[model samples]
Target: ALQHYHKPSIFNSDQGAQFTANAFTGTLKQAEVKISMDGRGRCYDNIFIERLWRSIKYELIYLKAFDDGNHLSQEVSTWFRWYNRQRPHQSLNNRTPDEIYYESCL
Candidate 1:
């Protein structure tokens, strides 16, 4: 994910082989991003993102049938744009994620 987007201050993921692979970790280290791994038996460490995934699957993926990868990618990107810029999150006090993020920068 970081390979294509803005560098994050910290990257958190489960201790899956892909995440722990040298190539991935080396890229993060070179970028000076902190690495965080979810501990064993602590499932809720990534609950928020997991919840977002659930929302995406149920609300978008499950509801659409794409003809190709490009189609799926475009639709997913559109969904994410709406999710960040329009959809209000209850946990964020009914504000969109984009709103909260830009507000924090100020």
Candidate 2:
């Protein structure tokens, strides 16, 4: 990740001493990247990931019980493919993510 992407202007994370440690903050400081933190005990810090977990629980994970870790992994992979390539999101103007992404690439 460090090699492939340009340094971001700001990084957001929940409060953790490890993140606040000099080693970590020093790197961001050297890079001139701003660090943003969530308020303690606030639930909104991980809203997007939380929303995705909600969707997976309601739409896929709760539908059937998996016999093993491999089965669960496979099903999650399939669900992601269906999510990105097939399902239309109303917020995206009823287009699948792949459609919007690939259109821009071409």
Which model scores highest in lDDT?
A: 1
TM-score of each: 0.88, 0.61
Q: How many angstroms is residue 20 displaced in model 2 relative to the true structure, after the best TM-score fit?
A: 10
Model 2, residue 44: what's the lDDT? 84
Q: Which pairs, if any, clash in model 2?
A: none
The lowest-lDDT stretch of 10 consecutive residues in candidate 1 is 40-49
| lDDT value, candidate 2, whole model | 0.86
All candidates: CA RMSD in angstroms? 2.0, 4.3
For residues 1-106, could you state the per-residue lDDT of candidate 2 as single tens digits? 4457768889887677987898998888888999987888775886865677798899999999999999999999999999999999887899998999889868
Worst 10 residues of 2 by lDDT: 1-10
Off by over 4 Å in 2: 1-41
lDDT tens readout by residue for model 1, 18-88:
99999999999999999999996676998987899999999899999999999999999999999999999
TM-score of 2: 0.61
Q: What global local distance difference test value does model 1 have?
A: 0.92
